[model samples]
Target: MRTLILTALLATTTALAATAQDASNTLDRGNWQDAASLGASLDSADGYTIAAKATTLGASVSPDSAKAALLKKAQSYANQAIKLNPNSASAYFELARADGRLAQYTGILESLGLAGEIKKALVKAIDLDPKFDEAYVALGLWNAELAAKGGGASFITGARGDQVIPNFEKAIAIAPTTIAHRLEYANSLLLLNRNSNRSAAIAQLQKAVSLTPVTYWDKQDLAAAQKKLDALR
Candidate 1:
């Protein structure tokens, strides 16, 4: 009886290991479709993470008319990832990103509520992974946006102007070459729209404009950064 039980446990462990390896292999595929097929293959943490990344990519480039569908897909994948691995900080970040983008498409009241969610999820991500530099960018942008909205909006949104610059600076310190972090920081600075801050925003944009594109979104954002720099001049 003892031998039989040991054999059964070993078999189960081997099978689980194989499954995990397969999932990791599927996730390594460059194409989003490949990741989607594997991630949507029953319940799997890696599957969910890859699927969420693909969906977020879609959301990033999609037009306003199509963004909703992409964000919804991202939300589904992110939720699945969280369900499979509740401690997944990256999953939570993707979920927060989907909500933030969705809020942009919706009304102001709904947007504020989503902003609150963004704040919460970003904090959770940072708590889970102290080196979550990407989360810091989003959180800084949140503070900057609310700060730009004036006293009434600040009161409603519970965002602090004091936190904006530091969070963004931390993200840059953590990942200096990350084009998205630089762009986001510049954007938040421009949101201030004060004559004093415009030069600082321009400086950040110039740095981003000089970097080589590392991803598809990087290409799009670099173009925008150049345009913004031109406008600033």
Candidate 2:
């Protein structure tokens, strides 16, 4: 009986690993929808987390009209991941990303409501994994966007302008060669205080443009970085 039980457990583990590998292969092939679908079908926290990430990545390239739906789907997957594994830092990070993207399509009050959720999720993700560079980038953007809104937005969201650059700098320090990290940092610098951060922003953009893109999303970010740098110069 013990031998049979051990064999069954090994089979289950192998199956789970196979599913994870297939999902990763689909992602590497740039089949975002397929990867998301495959991930959703798996019965594991890691699977749901990958599904959330794939859906979020798809939303980034989707039409504005379709983005909200994709983000919503990603949010659901992230929630499932967190439910299954509360300690998953990537799951919380994905939840934060989905909420941040959805905020773009919402009213001011609604967006502010989401800002709190985004901050909470990001903080949890960072607490779980201190090396989560993407969370820092999103946190920086959160600060920059709210501070840029001025008026009551910053005060209501508790977003301090002082936190923006430092968060981005932390992300860059953690992932110096990541194109998206540099591009986002440059963009957030401009958003926070363009005139004051113009030179620093330009340098980051230049670095982003110089980096080699390894994926479709990276290529898109690299192009954006180049365009922004050209405009700045």
Model 1: lDDT of residue 197:
85
Candidate 2 CA-lDDT value = 0.92
Q: Which candidate is the best by TM-score?
A: 2
Off by over 4 Å in 1: 1-34
In angstroms, the error of model 2 at 58 is 0.9
Which tens-of-lDDT digit does each residue in 73-173 have in candidate 1?
Answer: 87888888888898999888888888877877888788887888888888888999888998999889889888897887789879988888999988989
Instruction: Report the alpha-carbon TM-score of model 1 versus the true structure.
Output: 0.83
Cα error, candidate 1, residue 27 (Å): 9.9
Tens-place lDDT per residue, model 2, 118-181, is 9999999999999999999999999999999996998898999899888988898899999999
> What is the lDDT of every predicted structure here?
0.80, 0.92
Candidate 1, RMSD to the unseen true structure: 3.8
- Superposition error at 150 for model 2 (Å): 0.2
Query: Where does candidate 2 stray beyond 4 Å?
Result: none
